[model samples]
Target: MQQTILEARHIQKQFHDPVTVQVLTDITFSVNKGEFVSVIGKSGCGKSTLLYILSTMDTDYTGELLIDQELMTGQSDAQLAHIRNEKIGFVFQFHYLLNEFTVLRNVMLPGLKLARYSEQEVEHRALERLKMLGIEHLATKEAYRISGGEKQRVAIARALINDPHIIMGDEPTGNLDTKNSEHVFEIFHELAEVHNQTLLIVTHDQGFAERSGRIIEMEDGRIIRH
Candidate 1:
């Protein structure tokens, strides 16, 4: 059966930082299984906040979010963590590879903590992902040893090692140079189009955002258009 990857509706979050700050209000969107969707907006538009909410990393919100028919309204912290590790993959602007671990070990960490796959299984899978991203040659190197583009690729491989149902990336290309940014965007495109992985990316790059299957523009804590 086809899966319903994510459904987000009427989501709102307020930040009481010194004063009352309404970050997101009445934001609604849905991403189908194996779809690639981009959220584009200027800074302070609550794009990252929305991504955080959808990833189940932040539950302090008012809204309805469903993953595979599971409502996320009342899941506890532990339950949410389980759901996140097992179901969602995330990429950040900076490649958050553990500086001390080898590329291969870094990729295998998520699966290890989740215990979703055996150690050997995780190793094999991580190697496979590394190979797919053409960074297998650097798998034995420390995370800090690789080049920027290579590190981003390692980050991508790690994100995929779990075979997540959906991948949420927050400004994944914001730190890379032009060439590296294009390369990273290409990887994201392939992951969604060729590999049929559901992708929800928050990007400030207009060029990159235009390539997504659909673009949702956020403004002033609300979705302005699609």
Candidate 2:
């Protein structure tokens, strides 16, 4: 049986304004190791909110979350941060690369957070990932110098540098052209199959969602039954 990499139980989240706004109600799901899952929804749905909660970034909700046989709700703030940094990789719609940093440096930035690897080791690993993704030639280039697709590939490399068991992406290909989007989606599939990384993507594109092993539809802050 495949190991469960991440799971959410009875997850509930609400936001407050002049009136209470409920975003997710009893949302729950689990991701097995190396599985590729995609959640699709319209804008204003709780897809992003669910991703944040499941990824262990936001803890304002109430419920149980487990990662690698560990209970996430009981973890201290520092412990949660370490878990996110070490075990979960995130890619956002915006590339989020530092303008002044080169592609290689951008990829290696996350490695600095973990102390075990030597600088040379970090460089070697980053280089290998870049080459594997066919982005090695752009390593020394500034962030702005790369195309939208290349920037997304570099973002994926950054995510992989942490050796994360679960990779989360929010509209990772939204801003790209059709061809670029297809390529980026292919890379995400590669991440799941080749590297055995559990992948979750939040996307408005049904095409991308359909490509995943599982598709979750979200609407009005809840997962829609298909």
Positional deviation of 118 in candidate 2, in angstroms? 0.8
Relative to the true structure, candidate 2 reaches a TM of 0.96
Candidate lDDT values, in order: 0.89, 0.89
Which residue runs of candidate 2 sit more than 4 Å off their true CA positions?
A: none
Q: Candidate 1's residue-wise lDDT over 1-226, tens digit each?
A: 6678898889999999899899999987778887889999999999998888898888999989898679988889999998888888889998889999999999999989999779999999999999888889998999999898898889888889888989889988988999999998888888888999999999999999998889999999999997
Pairs with backbone N, CA or C atoms under 3 Å apart (clashes), candidate 2? none
lDDT against true structure, model 1:
0.89
Enumerate residue pairs that collide in model 1: none
